[model samples]
Target: MRVKGEIDAYEVMAVNPYKALIVPRMVSGFLITPILTLIGTFTGILGGYIITVMVQGSNAWGFMGNLFNWLDMTDILGGIIKAAFFGILVILISCYYGFHVRGGAAGVGQATNDAVVASVVSIMVMNYFLTTAFFGFNI
Candidate 1:
């Protein structure tokens, strides 16, 4: 926890201030949230396309066509950028809570359980707030 002391939980797996800071900071980026966010984005887009095709049926082409048409380079790029931020948030929260999950075998289980719940909740909350902030009720 940076806010509290300096455990460097997953950082170095050692003890060196310089290498610890630099290495850990870099490695921390790809921890959990970012990966989950990317996964969520892929699945979310797939789900959207699937539902559009399935529900729209005869109009699926039109739907997909319009969807792709509206999504210009900026929109797509914005999505990737936003996803990266969301991923960071999710990972930070998860790592914050899960970094200290320790005890024994049972503690490991608890850590995993907490990590999953935190990750999902973090994603959902971020998704809602981000969507609202970006598009809100206008869309």
Candidate 2:
């Protein structure tokens, strides 16, 4: 949402809401979302590492090293591939609900709420199916 009459990075970067599949909204989302996802992944990894270190206590580095060693180039590639779909999910959900902000504060508020809710749900659902298809890892 724009504040102080200032358009967001998304607003400036997003394409006109109607064009093709890879429009500005999608492009911006694709660019920025991986960073957010990486933060979440790293935070989760750190928490798990700390817990393993404390609970297991004997071999924290060894465990983490082994887990990370499994994350080869193909694993990173798969993650990047998944992130692209997540970005697509976010942009489509947001733009689906948020294109008509000119409808006023109430409309904008509802749209923002819907955007967040839809993005989250879409990501969760898409992640499950995509991960299942790509790695057969049923999350």
Candidate 3:
């Protein structure tokens, strides 16, 4: 159960008992979030293009023209911001639970379950607050 370039878990704890294991994960999240968002955005637009042009027989030029016309800079920026925050939140929650895991395999399983549930809940709750903060409630 060893991966190349990966230190043994026990060895890591031995060398730095108080070290925060989440730091690298947080850094990775920051790096990965924007790249994922860009890929997802492109894939979504491509899917729309496929549906409109290939399936529905719409002109590609008109499909793209309408798509670009309807999408605004704010929409793209807001999505990126939200993605970044969500990435950070997910990493933080997972690391918090992972770092605190105890009682062997059972504890690891419990920690994983808790991390996933907490992350999803936090993301949903935060998304609402973030959306409201970024674009004030209209009602």
Best by TM-score: 3
Model 2 lowest lDDT segment of ten: 1-10
Once model 1 is optimally superposed onto the true structure by TM-score, how far is the C-alpha of residue 129 displaced, in angstroms? 1.3
Task: List clash counts for every candidate, in order.
Answer: 0, 2, 0
Give all candidates' CA lDDT scores. Answer: 0.64, 0.73, 0.81
Q: Which lDDT tens digits does candidate 2 get at residues 2-114? A: 43333444456774325533377788888777777677778888888888888768587797789877877766667777897888787877877765454568778878998
Model 1 alpha-carbon miss at residue 32, Å? 10
TM-score of each: 0.56, 0.66, 0.81
lDDT head-to-head 2 vs 3, winner: 3
What candidate 3 gets wrong by more than 4 Å, as runs, is 1-20, 137-139
Pairs of colliding residues, candidate 1: none
In candidate 1, what are the lDDT values of residues 93-121, reduced to their tens digit? 66655556566667767777887888788
Q: What is the Cα-based TM-score of model 3?
A: 0.81
RMSD of each: 6.1, 5.8, 4.2
Task: List, residue by residue over 36-95, the lDDT tens digit for candidate 3.
Answer: 998999999999889889999989999888888998988888888988999999998888
